[model samples]
Target: MQACANWIDGGPQPSRADQWLDVTNPATGAVIARVPLSTAEEVEQAVQSAERAFADWGCWPPVERARVMFRFQQVLRDHFDELARLIVEDNGKTLAEAKGSVQRGIEVVEFAAGIPSLGMGDVLKDIAPGVDCEMIRQPLGVVAGFTPFNFPVMVPLWMIPIALACGNTFVLKPSERAPLAGLRIAELFAECGAPPGTWNVLHGTARVAEQLMADPRIQAVSVVGSSPIA
Candidate 1:
């Protein structure tokens, strides 16, 4: 059994906790690894970095933003096997299901590159003489996403890249149970020219989620969890 890790700031680091949780291979019922239980403090650092990044990235040109998304789409497609293996190892899903989720995540990146159009605007009416009125869609600033274990790849796809494409920096609070898939997506973002602070991933339990939603710097949150979803 290896240690399931937490990635913070930019790279992997040891959990400060002496108390670690056993991550069993759900399919085999064997103790596959130990994942560090992250502290609330770590979560805050990741959020602060993302907020700082939002100041500049929010104003980045949409076409340039799309370029990053395009690079991510290619990287994920090329590394599909590694992604699927990690998903199956953590979540106990069948190989096919894992592959499907990766594919969908790729599609979301594709969607993001194209959704630049969402930011486009049309000048409706020209006022009298030289005066005119115009409107354009802009970024929503720093956004937060809380993803779930059931669909690790797909749920994050529904959140992170879209927020990035929309020109917002983000703090992604992925599920502790199956967080590696989310981490893999973060790597893709880094590869695609997403500046480190532009997209952040924090590993923890519910407290990590609360900190993100409660923070005044965060502009919005999209969470997917709970069976009935109240």
Candidate 2:
């Protein structure tokens, strides 16, 4: 069976984990692949990688960052059909549903590509005599996202593109049951010429998420799941 790998530092890497969980196709009882139950140390590595990249990535102008999103948008379009297929394979969504989900993800990327305008700060000239006030936006150092099994591609896209466009480095923990779409998307993002360590993915169970939430290095976290999981 195929073994899924983690995307770290702009490329795929074998997990250090000694244990793994099977990723089965929902439509059938077949084990399509195995995903690592990534260790806490591995999770830390992902966080540290994002933290290191933040120094440079966070300094990029919003327009330049948006340009990366634009390239990513194009790359996603180039592989649109493939992404839809991956979603169908991993999540067992119908071909039409998978296509719709992928399209929704692409739309988010399109919105992220416009962050140059959307993320602009505001300035108010002289409310009081000779005084001015301004609000400027800045990137937090590192952010993480936890996505559920359903709508794998769309959920991760909801967080990854916007966060990166806003200049925050990201570490994503995709659902163990359906992780391929997110991993493939990370590869496409790297091809868009994003710097190494700017985006990373780790596959595991809930413990990985706990590690993310407990870590001081993660400046923010986004989770899509049930109320208890949230």
Q: Per-prediction TM-score, please?
A: 0.89, 0.97
For each candidate, how many residue pairs have backbone atoms clashing (under 3 Å)? 0, 0
What are the lDDT figures for the candidates, one per model?
0.78, 0.90
> How large is the C-alpha RMSD of every model relative to the true structure?
2.5, 1.2
Off by over 4 Å in 2: 227-230
lDDT tens digits, residues 72-128, model 1? 899988999988988888788899999998898889889889866867887857577
Look at candidate 1 and give me any clashing residue pairs: none
How far out, in Å, is residue 132 in model 2?
0.9
